[model samples]
Target: MDIHFYKISISGIVQGVGFRPFVYNLAYKHNCIGEVYNDADGVLIKLGCKDIEVFLDELQALAPPLAKITKITQETIEPFERSDFVIRQSHDANSSTTILSPDIAMCDACKKELFDPTSKRYKYPFINCTHCGVRYSIIKNLPYDRINTAMGVFMMCDACKKEYEDPTSRMFHAQPIGCNDCGVKTFLHVNTTTIQKDTLYHTAELLKEGKLGAIKAVGGFHLVCDATDENTVQKLRQNKHRPTKPLAILVKDFAMAKKYGVFSEKEKEVLLSKEAPIVLVKKNRSDLASAIAPGIDKVGIMVASNPLHLLLFEYIDTPLVATSANLSGEPIITTKEDIEQKLPFVDFILDYNREIINAIDDSVVQVVDEKLCILRLARGYAPLHLKLPKKIDEKVLALGANQKASVAIAFEDNLILSPYIADLDTIESIEHFQSMIANFKRFYNFDFDVVLHDSHPAYESTKIAQTFDTKKVAITHHKAHLLSVMTEPSECVSFVFDGTGLGEDGELWGGEVFVAKERKYHFKPLVLLGGEKAIKECYRVALSKLFEVYPLDEVMELELDVVKRYKSKIPLLYHLFQSKKNLKTSSVGRLFDMVASIVGVLHEQTYEGEAGLRTEALVGTLTREKRFEFTIQEGVIDIAFDFFASDFVERFYATLCSIVITLAKQEEKKVLFSGGVWQNKTLLEFVISELQKENIPYTFNTIVPINDSGISVGQIMEYING
Candidate 1:
């Protein structure tokens, strides 16, 4: 009687996820007896007798990559006599309710059973059995046992019970298993009133009919709507108070997707990948609806991540604009009660209380070539921390901006980018951030004595950091933008660009240029005479500058007269311009804004990025016979030297006035448009034409992200060297 022992430790997202059952099947396959249980660290296992080395080797090799093996301690020991393998109760001693991974949509295996007519879970919207489905949502505490989850309600039926007990079944010990007969189910409930529609077609009908509705999705509530129908789309947008910003479109399949936007092979592959994100694709050439993206040319599209989403498109067979259910800047709605209260503003509520343990908005991405570039990383790829390239001296916690919020941490020189959660002001997001910091601390047991935050001193993330006694470092706005360039191996003068950041002299900074390295950066900001104050003063400086320049013709001479005509509407703009001290910035974002405002494209912004959005769109109309000349003067400092040749303000006022005078909807061409604003096709094409003769090496956001979201990587780089 040879007593042999095998010790196993599981890692990654294995603890709360169903790794134990997977282990059981493997043990059964190898004809070995083992006992598996959960621990604070991860999964602990003991296998007994016969050929243990080969079995352990195989199990470790086959372990899922998602299951990160941070550290595995294995030892040979005497095996305890056991007839079969069993998943024992969790060890209660160190059950830290650590933050778990964000919920993922159902996998194909589960989707098959869900939609198959012959299966017990046929048509089950919430038919997940641990291989893939909502996990973090249902969990109330760590250890992830059924009693600790939202699934504690609905008792299991006979079939589900047997499946849960069967080690061979996929649902073996799955905490969130079952269907309408024995598990969670959906009902068409609006304003707390339950409806009788059991099928998705009927539900879609109510949605198409403009009935206010709420959909309880994997992570939270989605206020879904008909996108193709202009009236329906308008109604939802109006009700949500979201007027200008483009709403994301959720399509059925890749084929229907072609109807709205164009995708290259690179874009298509990224779209179909497991981490399904709402990808921003360019519109080919069509009259789908001006209202879809309003002033922009790009559309955010996502496929069905779950069975319910698949069924949704089949019923309507139409494109749907699926946005998070919440007021502007609020967290996504996650509960049925949230729907009941918010449904009056909507038409109906589609939800099931399967328990949402975590909150995540739709993740959005884009592909330039073969590599996928993340625009907004959430859902399928969040809370999954990335390892840093080198070790650092101190642990620094980074509190990112208020919107598209993500908190970062540096431990042992590895940087972990947290997932985006809405509203830093809310207790939920703040609490989530704080708890996540602690969760990482406990797992790695790192030295967390230092803190780093955005220089926006007023951010909620910074206010929270005040409670900690850690040494803190403040990263400047543009410097961080420059740093994003350092993360990649390529070295270039970072044309750090975006919409907003506090300038060094305490004014808004956007567009910028920086020659960067890991340690330091030389930056130049694109600013007005008094920074934003000048712009607010109706660009009095712009008018003054334009008047002083020798006029090429009377078309340019109209500048001062133009300033006087708008006095009634722009009294403040003139004041801010004259009163402020020397304004300076190396901001490219503001450069675009100034151009847009000068162009009179979006004088009064309705949203956060009105100027940028409009400018990019306006560029498309131009036939570029020539390109503008931009040069670096006095070292790396960039100046609009050629722009000095023209009284741009006069030209701007003249052109805009002419357009109104002529009752024309569009305008003429100018400069090479790139950066995020290029996302607007109108501006993209316009810039190409006006500067056509220059024929500069024109490029838009291809492999690189054109939006402000890319600034995080820039932040990481600047901080490392700065």
Candidate 2:
């Protein structure tokens, strides 16, 4: 048989994920002689084969489990003599489209070897193999090799070296391959004492005593304590300065998780998957300390996604409150110095010597309408790659909204989103955002043709995009949200609701309904008093709406108890609304804030979406469905609030659903829900149920976050289409 010479290139999350080892084994099995190597672009394979079709089919069918092949290319090459298949060293040839894989949870095979006494990696804190281990978090650069990773410092031992060299061994060419003799070491610090011996065991003992410990995991440090200990949980909250925000806990397994939180079969599958994200589940038992989640009925829970955490369960039987080890509103702690400096209140610190190049936080998800929706995308779930429905000619960079920020890069028909970045208000978070953008540019090695940003000129991200030496496109914030989840180039009636975004008409838009066919708007503009300061004070928003339809004296005469309670602020708010001095906003989020303040649930916004979240939580208790009087005349919704009672919350949601369905019927188009407001479970459920009852087709974001974190994706989509 005559041999054929071929060169193949495979792209996507193929590096640092056993792709080379997989290619080496496949070549030997298929009786082909060639060399496989890694380069700046992706995997490069040169092969000499008699029947190339069979070889290519098998390789595609049996790629490594961790490898995600986004694109594959093959071409005829000049013949070269080679005796046998071999793995070659990685090279930095040129700008590459190859992207690093997100850090994956430890596979069961590695977990088994870690626990077996006969295995060389038994009881090893940093035990990892070819199939699973750290990837993006530890990687410093591309052509992902040991030298480009934090693990480069830990040279392999003789036993590991042998396995890494053997073609038949699972760890052949595994960059992170290591054994107990030559792996990262752990240390335990308790108060002023530092102990190198029995660190894991002693840390477990401390947790059992209701003491909090900062434990280093794959991404960053996590503050851990016994979840059953009320005082210990409370102490963690007080020290972290996180007063009422719910804490995430880590259980040993799915069965234990089910015992505390209700889980569906799909949810159980997600929890057991390699991603192992913190899943928000409804609480089934109240026996565990209520301080873990406080008044919230839903609790965020996760399982051990790494070896050290699984081993910790051996000494400690109960669940642990595993929250990010940083002060509230700060980035996650990665360096030991940060843990010591920022979180000195912890009883002990359990850490390893391995460096974390990218400090990622745990991803958080919730099941909405029986489908998983990402709340915060990071760790195993970020650097999200998606193939667009249509191809683009030039490369583009999209900067997301200011809050819950994320950056996206678009080239050809693909869009890759960076891991979720914090709000851009702080200096640290802004630096992190810029660093992520720089990293994406370096990794993809592309000259961006254009940069896309929110139309809000005041946004920091918008300002940053303007500084880039490329053509810039300003997309309306709500329009970007509508396009974020549009998988196809189709028109539909969309509802976009969030805290605030600059509208095309130069108004602050929070809640909006538009027909994509003509971009017609059907929204009631609610004037906001006090400009930017109005966001923090909900009473101003409530009084602003009251002043819109009533005389100043009549507004003062309203019988609402909350208005009476904060009677002093009404005079100033009324004057601001009358003069139109406080910026005019048509924001639905402010309406929620107004209602939240009116009911006396949340008066001031200490954090983003606080009023909306607290108001939605009340929906769980009130089963009564009532419709508040809302009138729609000449494309505006007018609600005359007669009372500020508990029933009004349910009424507002019900009325909103009715109006959306009515508009969808009139337009004769499917409905699309996008924005942060849909993140509210109560409002989402009501809207979904109403749509289903009317048999109206609707679509929501499943691949990306419904909030502004996904705005970058929409920005790219609109730019490409334009």
Q: Would you list the clashing residue pairs of candidate 2?
A: 511-588
Which window of ten consecutive residues has the lowest lDDT sum in model 2?
620-629
Q: Candidate 1: misplaced stretches above 4 Å?
A: 1-4, 49-53, 65-71, 92-99, 196-199, 284-289, 340-343, 390-396, 410-415, 423-448, 479-493, 502-575, 618-626, 641-722
lDDT of 2 by residue, 12-53 (tens): 878988889898888888788999999887899999989888
Query: lDDT of each structure?
Result: 0.60, 0.84
Q: Give the TM-scores of the predictions, in the order they appear.
A: 0.80, 0.95
How many clashing pairs per prediction, in order? 61, 1
Q: CA RMSD for every model?
A: 7.5, 2.1
TM-score of 1: 0.80
Write model 1 residue lDDT over 1-722, tens digit each, in one string. Answer: 45477787654467645678878888888777878987655688888757767776776788643454554667877647788878888765433322354566677788778778889888877777766766655666666678878888879999899999987787888788887688776777655577655657767887677554667777788878777677777877787777877888888889888788899887887777666778888876554546778876688888887778887766787777788888666678788776666546776777765767667777877664344656566777766445556666766667665545666665554455665665565675667666656655654445557676677778776677677787776676666655543344233333344556665657666544433232122124433654544443434434434323333243243444434455453444434434644565544445555565555444445565566566554543232222333333443333332333234433332232222211111112111112343343343343333334343332334322344443444455556655
